[model samples]
Target: MKRSSPAQISPDFRRTRVVDQTGIEERAARFTKRSIKQSSKLQALYQVLNMIDLTTLEGKDTDQKVRQLCYKARHPHDELSGIPTVAAICVYPNFVRVAKKSLEGSGIKVASVATAFPSGQSTRAIKLADTRLAVSEGADEVDMVISRGKFHAGEYAFVFDEIAAIKEACGKARLKVILETGELGSFDKVRRASDIAMHAGADFIKTSTGKIQPAATMPVTLVMLEAIRDFYYQTGKQVGMKPAGGISKSKLALHYLVMLRETLGQDWMSNEWFRFGASSLANDVLMQIRKEKTGQYQSAAYFSVD
Candidate 1:
């Protein structure tokens, strides 16, 4: 497919919505107050398990670690029958091939963090090359961090073009632009970054790299979801959302699902359109599932700490 030029595709960043801080915080708080029944809670726990992108991005990562994560993704909890596999296995670019080979035919995607992940402080040439390397290594999806420095300097066009260039380099792989909302500092900047990414052809807009503090808060995610909703309305295009880092509880994941349903509606409920970029979340969800089935909570020792 031919890619659109940044100038021809990107929306006017200056016109992006100015997020209402108080309103966003209050509304996001409302999602937590929602009461879920037993049956619905069980269903939501299963869905949360299915939507997780089990990840291992540590520098100490080895082939064995990637393989183990792939095994866990394939069989989350063998003790529980009918437990669905996770949405994907996320790793650094170096492990993309290892993960792809390990997860062959399991229908789980291998997502690689590219474009100088967690910090977009490299040259454009290097960033594009990083994206190409991941794609060439058989990555189904690429998670990229935007140039936060440039965005903070009011260099919106540079950030947009960088994302577009990386999208072009992604080829057939889905591109996930990580805004690193924690570093973006404010909800308004988060909204602008979301628009820039969607208009620049991001298949998904992610919240963090799990390497930064204050990553992926409910208010921040709410702002990004609203941005996605407005973009879908304007262009008739759909983009996925991934909230990485700091979300480790099953109840919080359920609240996120409620916020998604209320904000973007049912169209974005599936794993294809929404994902939780978490490693520990899967174990919590599995524990909840086991609890739901046996009427007793199992020790976290039963789950692997990947």
Candidate 2:
């Protein structure tokens, strides 16, 4: 029955002031080049990077591909030795059961995207029902996208209420609220989104859906992480963070890990607080792990990208 305070709601109603945040442009310009230097010895850092929870896959082909990836990650021998398994398998609601079946006894969590996913353009009743269905289907985690229209119109209360309601529907399963940060209009909006999500009972606050441009940029991520840290300082609750989309390269993932380390310290680097939500990014991490272990380039088909 927890809820966000009225002060955290949108503007002051009747004469709601428009919030302008031109300052984010400056911050983003500074961190746009987020890649780290690649060296022959960069393989040493691959062990600590966040293994992704891919959601862009589908159909029978994707299922088989993910099964192979899971096998290699969990049962690496010889060339695939020592690499860490991905944090979890992410899929649509219908596929949650399949992922659960595939990942049974393997310790990998099953995450499902719900709450009208990419569009989030539905009735609140339907959104809540979708969350319940995904959880009933056995998803260990649920990723729900906030209503961008509500957030954009300064309807912060609506956004916060929706998240709180969804959290209730989630029961024991963790709820990750995706801000789709790229569309939030400004850094303040992003920070506010992070705050609303966390205060409204989100176990984790995420960056993007990979369906929009300017998704998961380093500066925006930095801002979101800072918000998480600040919230923890105030409430003693540790909210997790995920920067999905546009994070495909191994170097990109490592840079994010580095940011998390420097910003939130080593405590948030684990799978519990950090997650990479990308389909193409997993193989890249695996490729780096393979190269480091074997000292040679592995074939594209040697791994799965689904």
Candidate 3:
């Protein structure tokens, strides 16, 4: 479903309107007001667990850590009996093989970050090699960083070609382009970047790398979702969304679900089209699910930390 090439993208992307920050923020704020009660809240909590891309991308991360994370993805809250596993386990490309082995046949995907993650500052050859290595190591998905420096410098073609090239390198692995909205500086730029990624063959247009400080705010996410909506309306292609970073509370994840359902409708509610890129979010969600089922708040110790 990838576009023919970057040449087909320039026209539509150039026509993108400047997003209104105030209007986007106001609309996003109202989404949190939707009331969710007992049974529905419990279901949404479990959905949050399934939609999470259980991530651990740290400089200090080790082989043992990736294995532990993959285990958590397969057996999140085993004591709960019927709890669903997370959608995937996200780690550095070096851990793709380790995570692949640990999650084999369990159906939990191993997502690896490539393209000089959190900092897209490298040659195109290096980035493609980085992605090829991860896919060769059995990554089910690849989350890649865009060249923010080039994007900010108005080098739209360069950024577009880079994503397209990386998409080719991904082979069978689904490609998620991390726009890193925190560094983009404006909602309009975020929308434009999203357009570039979506048209350049990104299966998912993600909001952050979870490495920067201001990653994945509601307003920013709203902007990207709208971009996805517009792109889908025009292309008949259904791209996915993943809001990574700082979303720890179950309530917040539910709010994001509400926003997604309202903005893109119920068809995009499934894990196939939506995901949460977070590390500690699983434990919080586990606690909420347990509280709903047993009427007691479970401690963090009961849940595995990915």
Candidate 4:
């Protein structure tokens, strides 16, 4: 693989084909109109602004806090009457058991970050082992970061192979291939990575790890979701979409949901097809939901994403 910055990359790298972009546009417009008719739907979409994955805390012991978060999601009705929790709980491999135990039999899915997350510099053996370990620990899904080194070098095949191997390791568990969109350099690279991950057997194609600075954003997430819609058109298999990073507001979450609903339709509106990945986001969504129901502001300290 040879390394080149986004600017140095050629037109060949920038090319992507959306099979029915016009149809997608039309559907998006129609969904917007329909979404406006359902007040609850509008409220839920607004909660997306506050969805967070809460993968780690740099200086804190997150275990006790994480437990509290899981508890809160399970009992959202207690703190915020008639409000549901955020979509899912995302954590490290070791903590999947915690999330599993906390969310036992709950509708919310347990997603574990695997494949030498953050750096993604581990060997194949380590990465595969990590995936297997997480799935065996009761993770409903696994989020694995792509090998950025190979990707930056234009070794798409290597990157693809690694993702496929990890997917195989997931067995019955779903696999989410994280492109770490920040490191991908451009929309073209992001699109290419999306294609590579989907073709390589990703059940979901996510935007970032939430550990990087340039975490998931609307434009990039928009691009990735578009790629997902295109792939579904060609393959007839829907891949889930997750934008995990810096998405800590209810309003923003709504935008992504709006984007997804517009691009992929109501079929992708459920938790199965859409998820927000931020620790802070869950509480924000909860707060907004509370306001919608009670028409009053709630205390933030009562909510925890630990």
lDDT (CA) per prediction: 0.92, 0.76, 0.91, 0.74
Give lDDT: candidate 2, residue 164.
Answer: 94
The all-Cα superposition gives candidate 3 an RMSD in Å to the true structure of: 2.5
Clashing pairs in 3: none
Q: Which residues of candidate 1, in runs, are more than 4 Å off?
A: 1-9
Off by over 4 Å in 4: 1-62, 298-306
Give the Å error, residue 2, model 3: 16
Question: Candidates sorted by TM-score, descending order?
Answer: 1, 3, 2, 4
The CA root-mean-square deviation of candidate 2, after full C-alpha superposition on the true structure, stands at 4.6
TM-score of each candidate structure, all chains considered together:
0.96, 0.83, 0.96, 0.83
The candidate, 1 or 2, that scores higher on lDDT is 1
Worst 10 residues of 1 by lDDT: 1-10
Residue by residue across 210-236, what tens digits does model 3's lDDT show?
889799988899999998887776777
Tell me the tens digit of each residue's lDDT in model 4 across 68-93.
76776566546444455555677778
- How do the candidates rank by lDDT, highest first? 1, 3, 2, 4
